[model samples]
Target: MRADLDIEGGVVVGIDGSDASLHALFLASEEAGRRDCLLHVVRAWTLRTAPRPPEVPPSTVPSVAEFHDWIVLRTRALVEETLPAPEDRARVRLHLPRSQAVGALLTAAETAELLVVGHRGRGSRLMLGSVAAICVRRAGCPVLVTRPHHRRAAGRRATAGG
Candidate 1:
């Protein structure tokens, strides 16, 4: 753990601007509140499209910055609004990055006491989203895959193997 980063009793959660992820955020916050730990919420984004030669090859991609900014803003608001009054914003930290969501989350989870994520955010239960599955399999800490409203979406095939 970085000396500047505080991970003692920290709970890291991934927020992907989806209801399921938001639920994960809420659950993480509640857990943190109970343990009096800090909650770290990270939202990740990637460039929608890479610049082509004819497109003047912009010096930098603005969309990346904008997406990260949006995630930070929205995650901060959701965290603040969902938590109880006693849970102060000072105890919550939001991170926005322009990398893969699962990788960013796993990195954050390295020093965290616990990691919380949704089972299938915006994806079918038959197939956990790549990010969620990756975190569950690779996170340094135990992962709680929350599914407060998980239901079998229509047309999802049943699998024989677990």
Candidate 2:
């Protein structure tokens, strides 16, 4: 995880291994490159439930560290897919925070020039996801909610087909 103190007037982006988030990352990278600033990629995770007995064994259940590791690995892959070139990757800094998505992103945006996130995440409903909505209303910096071009194309295709 990159230290928050290291971030200055850069672009902060929320990444969750979702397609929309990946698109946001791409945009954030472009913005960062244009500004000649670092692109901070943040992934926040929280344990949803405690391990229970009988149905689930403590040993069998993954630990918080394991979950964090998985998120980091997944986020890295997403970044790789978004930025194929080594030089483009060099401009990015990765962060994994153990907190809720909104809180983590809000904190990251405190000192950023711009905050970028996907319009929706893995299990979001409505056109504006809860996280994006909240961040737009409360983030310290400007927020950009990105929806992938392919998603928009699919939506248009569905409308035309119907």
> Best TM-score goes to which candidate?
2
Residues 122-144 of candidate 1 have per-residue lDDT tens digits of 54554567778888889889898
The number of the candidate with the highest lDDT is 2
> After aligning candidate 2 to the native by TM-score, how far in Å is the CA of 14 from where it should be?
0.3
Predictions: Cα RMSD each:
8.6, 6.0
- lDDT (tens digit, per residue) of candidate 2 on 1-162: 222334667999988777788878877988899988999998877776211223345669776767766677677888987788787799999887777788888888889999999999876767889989999999999999888756774584366441
**TM match of model 1 to true structure:** 0.71
Instruction: Record all residue pairs in model 2 with backbone atoms less than 3 Å apart, i.e. clashing.
Output: none
- Runs in model 2 lying further than 4 Å from the true structure: 1-6, 49-59, 150-162
Model 1 residue runs over 4 Å out of place are 1-9, 49-63, 84-88, 123-127, 150-162
